[model samples]
Target: MQRTISFADKPTLHGTNVLLRPVQASDVAASLEPDHEADRLTGTHPTPGGLSVEQRQDWYATRADHADRLDLAVIDQATGLYAGEVVLNELDDDNQSCNFRICLFYSRNRNRGLGTEATRLILAHAFETVGLHRVDLEVYEFNPRARRVYEKVGFVYEGTKRQALRWDGEWIDAHVMSILAEEWAVHRGYPEAPAS
Candidate 1:
């Protein structure tokens, strides 16, 4: 029987340095702050001046109403502040797969293994709790650090989508990567070679 998927049961995933919980309205203010580095790194080109308070307010306020996707807020354990978010969306029930994405609000949250831990927490919930067989992502070539983080969490390089992103008058390739449930059962987010 094919396992069905529902993200309605948002989880509060805990780690040594980060915590993942259902997104709340309070996180909106922090999210409104512009992170140019994050936008560039993630290949996101948002509307001029980013989201206004009212738009963000309505969006976050209704996060729970969607049962098709899981959206969780990442909180830094040390500072107890909303650092970012980890999402699993575009669910394919028959294939038992979904796409994963994560973003931290500010540069201060980068390079500290916070994103890595957050990624592992969400993947665990995806493969273990949600009974998903696969999770995939696309990372732009220019942002290698994010790709490295995904690889560390057991997502293997599948192929590349040439000119996937048009940024700053240049086209950039986006690398496609994925991880399987069986692979997660082995590494549990830490990639390693099977014994020969």
Candidate 2:
């Protein structure tokens, strides 16, 4: 069975200091490098359920073909280099909802406002172009930096899944966060309506 989905080309989203564009085939290898390095450094390598580099490439190819997933590469508009990646996944048509995930591949980009800005752009696209009523995400408690960015984007703490993830033989808690369309409108200071 085939799923109906949509993707926007050069869907330029303006961040505080970056621009977000659709992920291209050329970015697969480079994008995966940082993710792998980060995982190794943080001792959070993927489990059996996670995808390998080849698997991720295949997945990206599939996602690129489907409109249901919006995966974008965050670019630093100043230098025009790949800063990170952001994605709105698991799009549910019946509920008009999706979950989001983001990561800044380069360590140099950390602690800057880049992540927050990139997040805002993706959230705006999800709630605006994608016409999603709700957006949600899960973050490990250890990843305080990402959690902070999510909070800044108006994602409220819904609850926690105790010992939800096992990393390096230790259990970690996962924080469930979500934002409603109304909340997004309030954040953007606009009345609820589709973007033109």
Candidate 3:
């Protein structure tokens, strides 16, 4: 039997530092509030007015029903709190590729390796479980830290879309990166590991 990919069935993935599970409504109230620093780092545009709490809750409440994409809440195991989110969207069944993204709502969650572990967990699911051929993402050039995490997970730089984001009267380049199933088989999402 051919193994199939189904985003409809939500899953819980455990990692050393984090857990990836379907987003809960509580996560919206507790960890999904808009943060300017996260938006800037992820190159997301701030809503002109911002979403009402109800709107956000409704969004998270229905994430489990989406069949075409997977949205997982990043839970910090050490603190047992909702630290952030990791999403796999823009699915291309024909090509077996998807776009990847992640964000941590609070600064305390940043630089703690939670994001890296969360990323690896999801990528393993994408390639090992879902059998996707490729997973891609875009990172603003201004955020080298994020790019480094992507690199550590085996995503290779493909190219850059020049000045893809204009923020604060400045142009920011967006770097496109991707990892292939073949690559994942070799690295298992730890491309930076020193060979023993």
**CA lDDT, candidate 3, residue 36:** 84
Stretches off by above 4 angstroms in model 3 are 1-4, 32-34
Number of the top-ranking candidate, with TM-score as the measure: 3
TM per candidate: 0.94, 0.81, 0.95
Cα lDDT of model 1 overall?
0.90
Residue 3 in candidate 1 has what lDDT? 38
lDDT of 1 by residue, 161-192 (tens): 99999999899999999999999999899885
Best by lDDT: 1
Q: What TM-score would you give candidate 3 relative to the actual structure?
A: 0.95
Ten-residue segment with the worst summed lDDT in candidate 1?
A: 1-10
Off by over 4 Å in 1: 1-3, 48-50, 193-196
lDDT of 2 by residue, 1-196 (tens): 3433344333768776988887775667766554564573344665676777777767656656766778888888878888778888787877888888877786776778888888888878777776778889988878887777777778889999998877767888898999998898876523333567
lDDT of each: 0.90, 0.75, 0.89
| Residue 195 accuracy (lDDT) in model 2 | 68
